[model samples]
Target: MAILWKIDPAHSEIQFKVKHLMITTVTGYFRTFNLEVETETEDFHTAKRIEFTADIDSIDTNNDQRDTHLKSADFFDSANHDQLRFVGGKYESHGDEAKLHGDLTIRGITKPITLDVEFMGTVVDPYGQYKAGFTVKGKIKRKEFNLTWDAVTEAGSVVVSDDVRLMAEVQLIKQG
Candidate 1:
């Protein structure tokens, strides 16, 4: 029998970046996120599920004012939408690369998002726990999901890019 796994929150990271002022960039990370990975199947070719949920208020950009702004109504509206989630989908591994199909919800809008997943392989820890690593990267247009708030600069460049870059490192634990 194969062993499935749960996420080790302490070892996982969730982050995102977006163009700021059209010349600079802004990056932020969520200190809190949860994940569950199904790894019991020896046949990795088959559908394996990845479920994730992130706390919106945990966003950290190292700038208090900016962080507060991000949680305001102009952005995530954290008070109204306290979380961002991606729910179950299949995954296929080819060589070191994989593809994940799931629903990404932000600002209360749920949309289908496909992430380019790279399997960093798996190993057993010194403590004898099985672990898997993955690096995920994807891009989404804020406007497409109704996150259309923006400001134009004097040169006509928007303050925030329509496209946002999301990346994360997931650490999975194995079920005995």
Candidate 2:
């Protein structure tokens, strides 16, 4: 039987960064997201399945206008695609670090992506619950996913860079 692990939303976050105007980077986050992992044992290396999803409408950049634009057809197209999903595939580990390969789907497009993960180990919380933590980072090009909306400043600088950086601080609760 496979063991199930569920993300502890209260202690987890998914964020992304993109260079704006080729000068400053703007940070954004998916306020609503969920991840689940299935493993044969307590060892994450034995994980058989991993799935994640983030609600497109819950995106936040701290700027209402930018957030709205991101949800529009130009970016995430949240109106038609309510969520972005990732289904984990190959998992390669080296000591406490690992590479997680998965297919990420956004705006109806799916692409293979690899994320570097640093296992933060597991612990039994005061409430007697078993938990694990990880820090994940990755990069992806927006245009590849059809997020091609672009604008050029008078100086010929792109409004939003094509490259996007992904980061996640995740905590999971092991279920009995």
Candidate 3:
């Protein structure tokens, strides 16, 4: 039988950073998301499956106008494709350092991506619940997923950079 683990939403966060006008980077978070993992044992290296999804409508960047635009057709088009998803594949690990390869789907396009993961160790909580933590980081090009909205200033600076950095601080609770 496989062991099941689910993200503790209250203690997890998914964020992305992107450059604006080649100047400053803007950070955004998906306020609502879910992640589940199945393993043969408590060891995450033994994971058999991993799945994650985030609600695009929950995107927050601290600016209402920009947030609204991000949900529009020009960006995530939350009206159509309401979620961002990731299905995990090969998991390579060496001690606390690891690499998770997976297929990431955005705007209906799926692409292979690899994320660097740091296993933050497992512990028994005060409530006696088994918990695990991980820090994950990766990068993706917006245009690759058809998020190709473009704009330029008179001075010739692009509105948004193609590269987007992804980072997640995740905590999972082991289930019986």
Q: Write the per-residue lDDT of candidate 3 for residues 1-176, one digit (tens) a residue.
A: 89999999999999999999999999999999999999999998999999999999999999999999999999999999999999999999999999999999999999999999999999999999999999999999999999999999999999999999999999999998
Q: What is the lDDT of residue 40 in candidate 2?
A: 96
Candidate lDDT (C-alpha), each: 0.83, 0.98, 0.97
- In candidate 1, stretches whose alpha carbon ends up further than 4 angstroms from where it belongs are 1-3, 40-44
RMSD of 3: 0.5
Position 80, candidate 3: lDDT:
97
- Evaluated against the true structure, the overall lDDT of model 1 is 0.83
Quote the lDDT for 107 in model 2.
Answer: 93
Any runs in candidate 3 off by more than 4 Å, and if so which? Answer: none
What value of lDDT does candidate 3 attain over all alpha carbons? 0.97
lDDT at residue 141 of model 3 (Cα atoms): 99
lDDT of 3 at 44: 89
